[model samples]
Target: MTTQYAKPLPRVHDLNRAFFLGALDGRLVLQHCDACGHVWFPSAQSCPKCLSQEITWKPVSGRGRVWSWVVMHQRYIPAFADDLPYAVAFVELEEGPFMMTSIVGAEPEDLVCDMPVEVAFDQVTDEVALPKFRPVTGEAS
Candidate 1:
């Protein structure tokens, strides 16, 4: 179901469709290599470590920590002009893969390294849900 989504949309393909689909369902899915027992993001045709085509798209904990981030004061894209000074962060998931997204629950200035975060989806389109992160509060940091 397409809507009046203003921003750019991902090119849905065989390699990455599972990821987009899982996000739509409010779940985090990654590629699990049966041969090497490794999990990864940005899905691929085969395992990067073992080069085995035995891969499966499985759910993950959707929890991570902010490894690094940058607050963008410049408007690089016109659609993102309203989002200027937004925080773009790199999160290291508990499963080991790193995902680049924005943390929603905290202000950019308050962000710190190794901040606890969990996945939150922003449904920009009817078929695509952008995976984002948010601070996990009420827990020991």
Candidate 2:
């Protein structure tokens, strides 16, 4: 079953194709620099730490916390009118990268700073699955 995906889609390119593909397969991946042992997201060509080109896509624990969040009171994007007042959050992954994502399986009123969360994939299309998060519960992935 695939979503109709009424919202906009992310552009997949050489640098970020793996990340999107991994999510479609229910895995969370980030860029790892072999030379400097640094990991990051929103994939890049070189390590932000040492500028090393020896990077590989690595799966992460998909565990994180709600660093911060805000309620979308306005329908800035018309497609999201049905989800007005939704929470858009910044998740600090345990692997040390911050991902701007939506918090799911919970209510916006319940969100708090540093709340434990884990990744959940919303398969919008056969090729794209957006990574969202949920409150931690019983060995959350």
Query: Once superposed on the true structure, which residue ranges of model 2 sit more than 4 Å away at CA?
Result: 1-3, 138-141
Enumerate clash totals for all models, in the order shown. Answer: 0, 0
Q: Write the per-residue lDDT of candidate 1 for residues 76-117, one digit (tens) a residue.
A: 888889977899999999999999898897989989998899
Off by over 4 Å in 1: 1-3
lDDT score, residue 113, model 1? 92
Residue 39 of model 2, lDDT score:
92
Worst 10 residues of 2 by lDDT: 132-141
What are the per-model C-alpha RMSD values against the true structure?
Answer: 1.2, 2.1
Top TM-score model: 1
Candidate 1 Cα RMSD (Å): 1.2
The digit string of per-residue lDDT tens for model 2 on 1-141 reads 665888999999988999998998999999999998999977888999999999989899999999999999989899999997899999999999999999999889989888899999988898899999999976433
| Cα-based RMSD of candidate 2 | 2.1
Candidate 1 versus the native: TM-score? 0.96
